[model samples]
Target: MTQFHAYQNRNPASRERYPYLLDIQSDLLGELRTTVVVPLCPADLAENMRLSHLNPSLEIDGRRYVAMTQELAGIERKRLGKTVHDLGSYREQIIASIDFLMSGI
Candidate 1:
């Protein structure tokens, strides 16, 4: 379900069309974890990074600390992008897949 594979499944149109779906998928996954009583999944965490283009910073005793290097952010972004694109029927069956992930947590 890489972006290339997603592209192969749909019309050869601009990314604007599919990026929204990606956003929607990402947002829903995020909201579910933050608002629900259920546990978060690795996939949900991955999608959060993809949609937000940001990864978690450490927060020990309520003090936040992010990597000072920009290259770290770039590396995380690339990793998340590849992960989101690698899933099966990502948009169509996101919730079910997410539920499975939640159950595993």
Candidate 2:
């Protein structure tokens, strides 16, 4: 999968709060066949929190959501559903979110 491509979460149990997940893994690692994803939570829950260092707010399809960078993980390609949004424009913010998650800065 291409980096920064958003995918719809097919897991019904977790879809209500996290309807989308952003793939941060690069295409160069396609051989691994697994995607590293960051779950996106609804704005209401995200905005009321003070974890900006880890959860960065972002807009997807006009609705605001926070990228749960701390929840990053690798999952099988089949676990991801249809493409939801392409987060190419938010590349810098996404990267910064990840950097803060990893480095705490």
Candidate 3:
């Protein structure tokens, strides 16, 4: 999957809490079997949390979901379900968040 493509979470174990998984994997690794993703859980669940840079708030399908960037993971490409939408509008914020995670700048 291309970068910033939000996908439905197929796993029932965490579906309620994390309805979407934003694929942050670069398009350059198309041949790779695994893709990196960050879960998007309901922002209400994280109402008390204040780590904006680490977990930016995002709105998808009319619901507010927080990007759980700190929980980034690599899973099988097939694991991601149907596409939610392209997060092109949030690209800069996402990139900056990733940069902050890596360099703290």
Q: Rate the local accuracy (lDDT) of all candidates.
A: 0.25, 0.86, 0.87
List the candidates ranked by TM-score, beginning with the highest: 3, 2, 1
* Cα lDDT of model 1 by residue, 47-103, tens digit: 433322122232222333221111111112222222223233333343433443446
* Ten-residue stretch with the least lDDT total in model 3: 46-55
TM-score of each: 0.20, 0.91, 0.93
What TM-score, to 2 decimals, does candidate 3 have? 0.93
Estimate, for each residue in 1-105, the C-alpha lDDT of model 3 and write its tens digit: 888989999999999888899988889998999999989889999777648888888888777888888788999999999998888789988887888889998
For model 2 the local lDDT of residue 43 reads: 86
Residue pairs with colliding backbones in model 1 are 1-85, 1-86, 2-85
Which residue ranges in model 3 land beyond 4 Å of their true spot?
none
Which predicted model would earn the best lDDT? 3
Preferred candidate (TM-score higher): 2 or 3: 3
Total backbone collisions, model 3: 0
**Candidate 2 displacement at residue 34 in angstroms:** 1.0
